[model samples]
Target: MSDAAVTADLETYLSERVRSTPPSGIRRFFEIAATMDDVISLGIGEPDFVTPQPAVQAGIDALNDGQTSYTANAGRADLRTAISEELSSRYGVSYDAEDEILSTVGVSEAMQLTMLSVLDPGDEILIPEPCFVSYAPTARFAEANVVHVPTSVENNFQVTAETLESYITPNTKALFLGYPNNPTGAVLRRDTLEDIAALVQEHDLLVISDEIYDRLVYGEAHERGHVCVPSIDGLRERTILLGGFSKGYAMTGWRIGYACAPAPILRGLYKVHQYMIMSAPTVSQIAAHTAITECQDEVETMRQAYDERRRVLVDGLNEAGLPTFEPEGAFYCFPDIRSTGLTSEEFVQQLLEEEHVACVPGDAFGPSGAGYVRCSYATGLDDVKEAVRRIQRFAAKHQNG
Candidate 1:
C-alpha cells in the first residue's frame, strides 16, 4: 500500500497510561553524559566493583552442569529457601519460603509487579519526594496516582510519620519506602521507622519498603544493617519488602532479586511474575542463592571501600563550598547546588561540559531536588578524588565569574 493510503486508514493506537508516562530523568542525564570525553561520571547508581568471585563461579558451574532450563514461576525452591533463611537470620523477620517470597528479574521488576498486583486505576500510592525515580512511574503504569511526601535535607531527608500522615488519602493503597535511598543516600533510623510503622498501621495502608540499598550503609556503627519495617509492631503483615543482589553483591548484570510479603500478596505477585517473566534466569538464581548464603565477607569488603569513597566525596564537596548532606547508606553524595544560583540540571550540565565530570541533577528524583545534584562515589577512590577536584575547579571558576 502507498504511504498515504496506509496512514490514512488507521490511527496509531497506544495505551493512554503508556503514552502519558514520562521518560526516566536519571536515564536522560546518562545519555547526555555519554557523548562527552574525559568525563568523570557519578551519574549511575551501579556499584563499581565486579561481581564477587564466588557468585560468578557458581553461575559458571551451573551453566557447565547444564542448569539452563526455566525454573518455577516463584523461583527455584533452593533459592527461595536460602532467601528466607537469610532474611530471618539477618533481619529477624520470618517469612515462609514456600508462601511468602517470590524471586524476580530484579527489584525493578518486583516493583512493577507489586504495583500491578496491588493497585487499581485511580488508587493512590504515597511516595516520599526525591525518591528513586521508578516509584512514581511504576505506580502510574499500574494506573495508580502518586502522592509525593517531601522530605527535606534539614531532616537528613528522612521521611517522618507526620509527613506520611499528612499525605494519606482515602484512596491511598501503599507507601514506597526507600531507605539508604538513591540520590540523597539518606536512611531512616530505627526510631523513625518505628513511628512511621505505627502510623501506617493506624491508617491501614500497605508498605512497599524498597530496601535494595540496605546493605550499602556507610556511617555510624548502629546504622549498617538493614532495618525492616516488619520488625516493628503490626508491620509484617502489611509490608512487602524488596531486596536484591545487585547493589549488595555487585551482581547487577545477574538480574536476580526477591520480594518478601504476606502470603496473599506473594500469590498475587507470583501470578503476575508467571505471565510477565516465567522465572528469573536459572543460573542467576543459583548464583544469587550462593551469594546470599556464603558471600557476607565479600560484601563487607566492598562496603568498606564504598564507605571510604563516600567520605572522600562528601568531604571534598563540602571543601569545595558545595553544601552537602552526609549519606548514611548507598554510595552517593547529594550536595545542594542552590549556592551556585543554578538549577540542578544546569549545574550538572555545566559541570560535565566544563569540568569533564558527570553527575545527575537532583531535580530528576523529584520536585524538591531542584537545587541539588547527586554524585555517585561507587567508583575507584582515585576517580572520586579526581571528580572532586574537577568539581572544585568548576565551582571556583563559576564563583569568580
Candidate 2:
C-alpha cells in the first residue's frame, strides 16, 4: 500500500474493540517512573522476596534434566494432581485433575480464557468496583458489557448482595469477582460470599472468581481462611475459579496460573486455551508444582512479612494524614487522597515528582476508587517506612493547596 493510502486507511484497519478500550491507567505512572531516578515505588503488587529456594531448585532440576517439551494441554498430570489435592486439602472442594483444571501463562491468561469462553457479545458482567484494574477491561475484551457495582470502604470495599442485586439485568451473564481484592486488600468473609453465592445460584449466573490472594489473608481472615466461592454448596458447577503462583508464591515472572471449573465449563475454557497457548512454560509449571506441594513454610513466612508491612504502612499512612483503612489481605493500602485537595492522578503525580515516592491512583481501579491512592507494601520495610515519611511531607504541603 502507498504511504498516503496507509495513512488514510490505518485508522479504519484497527479493530473497534481494540481501539475503543483505553490503555492501562497504571502504565501512565510507570512511564513517568521510567524517566526518573531514585523513586520509591509502591505502585506494583509484586513481592520483593525471591522465589522460594525449593521451587527455584525444581525449575533448575527440570531444565537440567532436559524436560523442555510441552506437556498435556491441560498441564502436567502430576502438577494438576498436586493442585487438585491442594484445593481439596485447603478448601474442602474436590476437582478432578483430568477435566476440571487448565493451566496457562498466568492468572491473567486464566481470566482471558474464562471470559472468552463464557461471554457472548453483548452479555454483561457485574463486577464489584474498586477491583483490580484488569477485571473490567478483560471482560470488555471478551465483548461483554461491564456493569460496575459500587463497593466502598464503608463495607470494607466489598460488594454486598443488595448492591449486586441492584445491577442485575437479563443480559447479566456473569459476576467477575476478585477478593482478597487488589488495591484495597479487602478479603470477602464467609457470610458475604455465602450471600453472593445464593444470589448467583438464584440468578443462574456464571461466576469468575479470582482468588489469587487467597493465601495472603491476615488476622481474622487468615484464621477463618479464604472461602472458595465454587466450594459453596451448589455454586461449584457455575463458578470458574482463577488462581496463580504470582501472589502466593512470589512467582510473578514465572507466569504460571490455572483455572478450575465443572467439566462442561472447563472444556470450553480448555479449548480456547489450547488454541491460544499450547501450555504454560514447562519449567515454570514445575516450579509452581514444587511451590504448592513443598513450600508451605515459605509461603507462610512471606505472608507474615506482608502482614507486618501492612500494619506499619497503614498506621504510617493514617498518621501521615492519608487516612488509610486497615487492609486484611494482599499488600496494598488504599488511602483517601482527597484530603490533599487533588484528584487521584494529581496526588500520585505530585507525590512522585516532589517526594520521589510512587503509588497507583485509586481511579485506575474504578471511579469508586477515586479520591484515593493504592500503596503497595511489597517493597522492603525500610522503603515502605521512608515512603510513608515522604508521602506525609507531600500531604502536609498540599493538604490545603
What is the C-alpha lDDT profile of model 2 across 270-316, one tens digit per residue? 99988999999999999999999999999999999999888889998
List the candidates' TM-scores in order. 0.96, 0.97
- TM match of model 1 to true structure: 0.96
Task: List candidate 1 stretches off by more than 4 Å.
Answer: 1-11, 221-224
Model 2, residue 168: distance off in Å is 0.5
Question: In candidate 1, how many Å is residue 75 off?
Answer: 0.8
Q: How big is the positional error of residue 82 in model 1, measured in Å on the Cα after superposition?
A: 1.1
Worst 10 residues of 2 by lDDT: 392-401
